[model samples]
Target: MKYLVMVQGSQADYDALGGKASAHSPAWSEKELRAMSSFMEELNNDLAESGEMVDGNGLAAPAATRLVGLGEDGRPVITDGPYGETKELLAGYWVLDCESLERVTEIAERVLRAPAPEGSPVYPVVIRPIPDAGGGDV
Candidate 1:
């Protein structure tokens, strides 16, 4: 089965994540930064070797996002960025092809253990099996 693991972050705490630049920013000390990078690389390599990794990517900062909506008058309302509650922003995600939900859970546990800067709160990840949208057993 294929599963998509969403890395979710609360909008209220989004700004505290140092914004999107932190994804590639050198905000942490050299030692800490290096450790994080190494850890991520090792994790990717391990996943690739295990053949469970289908695709994954980190997202840009929310500030860079744009939202489009329609007003009650049927006029197109353009927004600068994500709308609604920031608490529901999807930070990033991974699509994994696993044999069972148990396997996906195992992978998620390992990912949750990944290194983050000190004092940063751990983000909760949502794991859901991807339903086959084709005309199959619904």
Candidate 2:
């Protein structure tokens, strides 16, 4: 089965990684960022070697996000992200094809082990199964 494992974050988290502090998170140091990157890279490498990784990437800052949807009149509307009421946004994701739910669950837990700055805000790692092309949930 294929699973999408997503990491959540807030604008504060992005700002901190960019070396700016916010009320919700502290600035991250170069060393801290390097540690986090190394951890993620190692995990990706392991998944690739095991032939379980389909795709994965760390997303750009929330400031680069755009919200696109249809208006009440059925016209398209677009807006910048970190929308006023949304405290969290998707920070990254991994698509993994694994043999069992337990294996995927283990991978999600490893994502939680990624390093971060001392005062960084911790968000969730969400897991959702992808539906097969024939249309039912996988």
lDDT of 2 by residue, 68-92 (tens): 9999999999999768698898889
Candidate 1 residue runs with Cα over 4 Å from true position: 10-27, 82-84, 135-138
Scored by CA lDDT, what does every candidate get? 0.71, 0.89
lDDT, candidate 2, residue 28? 91
10 residues in a row with least lDDT, candidate 1 = 19-28
20 Cα displacement, candidate 1 (Å):
11
Best candidate, TM-score: 2
TM per prediction: 0.77, 0.93
Q: TM-score for candidate 2, please give it.
A: 0.93
